[model samples]
Target: ADLPTALRLRRGAQALGGMLGPGLCGVVLAGAGLRAAMVMSLFLFGLATLAAWRVGSAQRPAETTARRGWFDEMADGLRAKWRVRLDRWWTLVGALMMMCLLPATGLLLPLRIQGLGLSAAWFGACSAAMSLGLLAGVAGLAPALIERVGRVRALAVAVQACAVAIAGIGLVRWAPGLVALFAVIGLALAVTQLVGQTHRMLAMPDDYRSRMSSAHLAIAHLAAALAPALGGALLGVATVPTGYLLLGAGFAASGLLLMAVPGLALFLRQDHEGARGWYDRHYPQAFTRS
Candidate 1:
């Protein structure tokens, strides 16, 4: 319950930043020039860094009797994550999800807009629509919707929603249609992300949380890194619409695969105590002996 709220607040802040950062840069560019805008961005980055440093300095470091090399620690994290069946399945599904979708927003969208003979301003409008949808999802819609549906079910629904939106994007050439599809994509992405985070918080033990998160991030980044090349290769051979259709099909397949994960739906549907009991019974090794 509280976890969802916390995630909402955190993601909401990020969504707002995504929406406002470009607008601020545009304002600076209009008022002064490109160089001024660049300088302003650097200044804002420095301020963010300083704030992060201050926050970190205020926290006490954890004390450990035994220290290990970074490589050894990373290996331990990977081992821990792989040992748990649920974690392993979730990580793979998350990676596939990222690979199937990241390229649509990062590379293909711009190309599709350009192919449609739309202006840069139209692209900006689509981007804003996405941000607004993201904000709406994180702030309110996701939590309420996820409460009504189990986390795993919500994730499945969100992924399918994203697939529909992506497929719609391929089929529609109108500017308004594109913008609406982008917004739906954004909302679905937010729900998927929120569910992923909430699952981690609920399922991972305290000792493994940070390590497992790092491992997940590494795998997700690797998948994301490969996504652009995959998108580019598709676009090189097929048209943009074809690329979108193929990606949407792949995404839909991933969602179907998620439904087949053993015991995941039951686990996610349980209360906190029930979930912990289920985890302990099914995956005893996931918990540290101490």
Candidate 2:
């Protein structure tokens, strides 16, 4: 189930890394001189566009024997499984967890350069360098970590790392430390994103993969949309660092949420037969009610 989707997810991770490299370099060069930045940004933007197109084109999934018309196929897939105690409830719980974390990450974006008192050019350089770190984390670190630790453990660790980095963002009392901290924050953000998405993909059922991805994306964007405005509002009531601290706290709490939620192994699709037999013997009436 969702073998195609797994391939697409891997490709998407690569494409995102490709865009981040040049796009950020251009942003930095622009700060050096407007004309230079503009030329570089344009060139990088063109490269990114091509990379995105390639990723999109590669997503045409090959049909398989189990494939059927989309809607009917999804319905049948859903019916074939024993509904776990938590499967239907997962959407809401997962979305709320992402909402807490994504906004906290987004809140760092605007404040990153300004808080450091660095030239926009330096910030751009960090962006480009950070992309390289992101690529390393995505392509080199992710597979080994996920395989060794399992999806839930990997994701929780990523979130905890992000929370620590977010708190580090508040330590930018000096310019030099701030620049270094921003790079670390960017690194943590990339790793967290990769691990989180992989966990989500592996946790969901095959037929609901796309819908699950959509739900994850929608909540993430909603968090991004609100973070800056909400962070700004908090700033009005407190210091800028205080606002960042609050956002960091939110992300740390999210690590707790992910840890608190039952592990994915408990809901493994392979366990459905055992679950069905248990339901038949112990909770037949409730099974029918569902």
Candidate 3:
């Protein structure tokens, strides 16, 4: 119940930042110059740093009697995640989704726009559209949609939507069509993210949550790092549309594979009490520190 609200607030802030940051940077660049725009960015970064420092100072640090080494902690986190069937499945799903989709938005989209002979302003508009879509999805649309369709079904539908949008981005020549596709991609991405994050928050024990999050981030980052090079290689061998089609197919396949996994629906549908029961039944040592 609370998870949805928390995720909405968090993702909303991120979406707003995404929407505003580029537009502000563009305005600064156009009015002042590249260097001035960069300086403004640095100033904003400093403000963010100060805000973080203030927040950190206000919070009391956790009391720990014994601290493990960083590597040991990370290894333990990975081991715990792998030991749980649900965690393992979702982690892999998240990583693969990142690999397939990141390149489409981050690398290929701009190139596709360029191929259409569109200006940078068009790309900016598409970006803002994506951000607005994400904001709309997370703020109200995702929760209601998830409730109506169910978690697993909603996720499946969102993944398929992303696949279609990405493929359309490659094939669509009109600038408006590209913006619409990017908006669809953003909305779908938001749904997937909300579902994944809510599961993470509810499924893991309190002691394990941060560790599991770190482990997940590491894997996702690795997949994302490799995605750009793979995308570039694909572009080298094929046209932009062909690359998008292949990537979209991979994204769709990932959803199908996830759906095929045993126990996934049950795992995602679990509530807080149900999730706790699941952990107890499946991994009795989940809460026990080694």
Candidate 4:
């Protein structure tokens, strides 16, 4: 479906940026001074601002039309039908996915690489491999995976895979093996996150979608913001392997909780039904196998 393609494109762009931004920053840091690096960041931010200005607000969402103030509308979204349906099962799963992996990739893995006495270049390459895997999954794997297993089941599998990969990251001493494991972890995260986002979008009604989407993004990004700090603290207290193992345990627990969600069968049926409908509309011949 077009939905899968759009999600892939969006995620691919993100992964590309994640892959490149760090290496670029490191170059600026090494070649020039910290002030030059700051200037580079400022230049990028200015370009982003220019792009946003060019985009304009011609297609603004109508969430502001609510009779109550911003806070009340935010409250409504917090209690929106889609949000209520998601419940804590999804919340924990999302939090664990973001909390465990972002930190592992962004902070722990690099430190681990450097701790092994590898060059900073190896650190950059290893970090980039995960994002590369994410891009690859978004382009080739996520769509088929979601359709084959249904979103919820796909999500469960992804989380469980991530848990193993995260732990494996701690055990590997070789750079190539570590890159492979990191790539697999990125693939799992991409599949889960892309599918998870699509599920949320499909579930939310048009009228309340914007507010609810903001709430969803807030949770995802907030965990990312916090995870680095938490992981850094954990690494301070224990070895990188132990920290990763502990984080993997959290992911495992979240996966198990998702499997135990109430009305999970109904949830899968609904998502699959929608997927089928999409296929029938977009690829009528797909129903031949229906």
Tens-digit lDDT track for model 3 on 1-290? 57656777989889999899889988998999999998999999999999888874325355561466788778878988888777788778767877888888889888888899999988888888889889989888887788898888889999999999988888888999888988898799788887767766677776676777789889988998999998999989999889999899989998888787667787778755566436546776655554
Tens-digit per-residue lDDT, 1-290, candidate 2? 45424643664476465547556556565467667767776897899799778874445444542455766544433432225334334444444545544444455545656665666555555455555445555555655665677655666676677666666666556655554654555555555555444444554444345543554455556756765667667767976576667766877876675555554444332222333333234323323211
Which stretches of candidate 4 lie above 4 Å from their native place? 1-4, 26-36, 58-67, 81-83, 148-153, 225-229, 269-290
Angstrom error of the Cα, residue 38, model 2: value is 4.5
Q: What is candidate 4's local distance difference test score?
A: 0.72
State model 1's lDDT: 0.79
Off by over 4 Å in 2: 1-112, 147-151, 174-176, 186-196, 202-205, 263-290
Off by over 4 Å in 1: 1-3, 57-66, 276-281, 287-290
Clash count, predicted structure 1: 0
C-alpha RMSD of each candidate structure in angstroms:
2.3, 6.9, 2.1, 6.9
What is the Cα-based TM-score of model 3?
0.93
Best by lDDT: 3
Instruction: Please report, in order, the local distance difference test score of every candidate based on alpha carbons.
Output: 0.79, 0.53, 0.82, 0.72
lDDT of each residue in 1-290, candidate 4, tens digit only: 46645766888998998788878988898999799999999999999899878985547645547356777666655555333544435665667667877777778876788777778777777778888888888887877797788777787788889899888878878878888887888788788777656655655454555666676666778888889888988978999889888878877886787777665445555653363333224323211110
- How high is each candidate's TM-score? 0.91, 0.63, 0.93, 0.80
Of 1 and 2, the candidate ranking higher by TM-score: 1
